[model samples]
Target: MLLSVNNITIAFKSKKVVENLSFSVDRGQSLGIVGESGSGKSATALAIMGLLPPTGRVTEGTIELDGTDLLTLLRNQENYRGRKIGMIFQEPMSSLNPLFTCGYQIKETVLQHQAVTARQAEAQLTSLLEEVQLTRQLGERYPHQLSGGQLQRMMIAIALAGNPDLLIADEPTTALDVTVQAAILELLNKLRRSRNMALIFISHDLSVVRQVSDHLVVMYRGRCVESSSVAEVFSHPRHPYTRGLLACRPRPHLRLLYLPTVKDYMEERPDGTIVEKMPDNPLLGATRGSYSPSQFDPLLKVENLTVSYQNQINVLHSVSFEVFPGETLGIVGESGSGKTTIARTIVGLLPLKSGKIYFQNYLLGKARPRSVTRQIQMIFQDPQGSLNPRMTIGEALMEPLHIHRLYSSRSERRQAVIDLLTKVGLEPDILSFYPYAFSGGQKQRISIARALIVRPSLVIADEAVSALDVSVQAQVLNLLKSLQQQFNLTYLFISHDLAVVKFMSDRILVMYRGKIEEQGIADQIYQQPQSEYTKQLIQSIPQYV
Candidate 1:
């Protein structure tokens, strides 16, 4: 075995996070660690690399690289950190230095491990970028200048600078477009074979893990619930959590009226024994959206909408679309496809150069009225950035009410906030906690509550559930559907995920390079796409084997 971890226990400040975990990987083999957030997958990677924080440590067990104890190397300070093992972090934007160019950063890494001069390091840097299917010209740009896929490629180049035998990738393809994600996976597998490198791939998305992994390890809360070959686990899941993960993803074949969550399958008793139950009937009364645009007048109309950046570069060009009442319009494309710009334009965040926007048949000028503003609200991609860290949940939810002057008294507004919290599956007592205290899924729920508190007519959800785990994503999607039915809401949903967009939208709009490629009924578009761009997007979606 190239790497072996036996009976390992990891802890932070004397509190155990990963207990009795064990796994192994051979040369030219890949082991996938599948779990949600806080499942201890990343912690195990850190322990193997000897990169744990000061408060964290390996409390017991052994980590061996080719039969050499890793813990002993750490104590001796002669470790094989960059020389024999490399790691690609989850978020490249945070891991890379913004002040330096990509080429400079990678060159530095190459120089650290190799006894090469500056000129020789430059040659190696060029070769690394080429190996990852990136251009050398892109190397001179800063991290922000590169797209999501390009940045990930740059990170791979840096990790390969050491020419290590093992690579640990933590959620490497999360939140990327489907095509970009597929390309990155292919690149990783290619590099692994060319170099005979062992890999530890970590992710919350099971479909993604299925594409690259040889063996699978399913984790929940800090324990490995199931371990087996990838095909065996998918064919017959022994653990309830594993079954839940497999059944929760949005399938491209059809739409489920209500997606099943993990809690619907099992429950843990007070004594720590698990009780299994039959999964909820996800296909009961499963139906597709039947809204007809010809019946009702358009709720929102955009004609010749165009938006430009501060540098006078147009990101959106002559875009036009209409959203009918009580229907969802899904917009999908890759990065730089103006999917987000259209959402910002509808919500009055950007100024149009020459176009007309009519909400409720009222023309929206450069300066929108308060009535128009209250009727249109937006949910951003990153819930953590959208919320205020210092404000309590109660205060954050009530601020919109205060601005709109909806309720008569402060007490009435407080009650309204509590009611909204309950609707979103959160307790009233959590109002006292700050945003940082909640998990990613919980924070997204809070964001949803804050958006719906004002009772808006149109809700623009922009990549809202892309960052969530499959099970949490199912819960949130179901919640959104329920809320839509109860409130008679209209959603202008935007996502790069084709399957998700298919599930949520009545009509689909394909956007490519700031232009609308095609728009039609959701089912028709998915079954027989007219445009090559739409077909390509659908083909890029990862399929389970």
Candidate 2:
């Protein structure tokens, strides 16, 4: 075996995070670890790589590589980690040093592990970048200067610098578009095959795991409840959690009135067993529309929109779209395809170079009225970054109310915040808790509640559910749908995940290089794509089964 984890127990302050986890991978083989957030998937990876946090410790078990125990090597400073077991972290930005060039980092790794001179290290760096399909010119740029895909490729280059036998990737493609994710997965598979490197891929996307993995482990909390070949597991998931994950995926083919969630698939108890129930979503039928683009009365309209940055890069060009009242207009595209730029422009964050925006038949100027701004709320991609860490959830939700001067009294505002929390399926007491204390799903719900505090008519969800687990994504989506119906809210939903877009959108718009490649009803766009770009995007979506 290239790597073996035997009865490993990872803990923080004596609290077990991953207990008795065991898995093995041979050369050229891939093992996938999947579960929801807080399921200890990353913790197990960190334990294997000897990169756990300060308080975290392996209380039991042995991780062996080629008859050598890695724990002993860590104490000896033998450089076993980077040389023998390369790690690709969940977030490339944090894994990489922002100050150093990508090439410098790769070269440094090579020099540290191998007995290579400066010239040899430079040569190795060039070859490694080439292997990862990153150009030599891009190698000179800093981490922040590169796109998400480019940065991830750079991470791969660094991981391959030492020519390790085993590579571990943790949620490597979570933030990427489907096309970029496909390319990255293909590159990893190719490299693993050519170099005969064992791999451990951890992710919440079961479809992605099925593509890259030979064997699979389904984790719940800290326990590995199920293990088998990828084909066996996908065909017949024995564990309820595993079954839930597989069942909860938002299919691009059909617009399900209610998404089957983890809660729906499991019985609530000490140990959740298999069960079935439709989640409560009264707003779904109420908000649903069967109208065409021409039929929808424009609640918010954008015409001849063109935007540019200081570098003279045209992020958006002649883009036009209309979002009807009580409907979701989903925008799907790659990282630099102007999806976010469009949202920012609508929210009055970015300078409108040349365009006309109207809301409720009123023309919005560069300096939009406070009333106009209040009516249009935006939910950002990063829920963690969007909410203030210093403030409690209550304060965060109350800020919008205060800004708009809605309620006259503090008690009334507090009650309003509680009501908002209730609407989003959160406890009223949770308002006193900080944002960091909540999970990704909870934080996003908090963000949704914050957006709703102002009673906005139009809500711009910019990749809102991109950074979440499949089941959690379903919950947030259902909540959004329900809220849309109850409040009659118009959603300008933007995301890179076409599957997610298909589920949430009333109409779909495909963007490429700041231009709309295709626009139609969600069903038509997904089922019968006209544009080559749209087809490619759809084809790139990973298939688990």
Best by TM-score: 1
Q: For candidate 1, lDDT tens digit of each residue in 1-545?
A: 99999999999997899999999999899999999888999999999989899999999999999999898886653347877888999999999999999999999999998889999999999999999998999999999999999999999999889988899999999968999999999999999999999999999988999988999999988899999999999999999988888878877777567776788778889987778878656654376655456588999999998888984888888999999999999999998999998888888787777788999999998788888899999999999999999899999999999999899999999999999899999999998899999988999999989999999999999999999998899899989999999999999999999999988888999999999999999888999999998998999988865
Candidate 2: which stretches are off by over 4 Å?
268-296
lDDT (C-alpha, whole model) for all candidates: 0.91, 0.88
Residue 25's lDDT within candidate 2 is 97
Off by over 4 Å in 1: 75-78, 281-285, 289-291
Question: Per-residue lDDT for 142-261 in model 2, tens only?
Answer: 999999999999999888888899999999999888999999999999999999999999999899998889999999889898999999998988877787788778777666776767
- TM-scores for candidates 1 onward, in order: 0.97, 0.95
TM-score of 1: 0.97
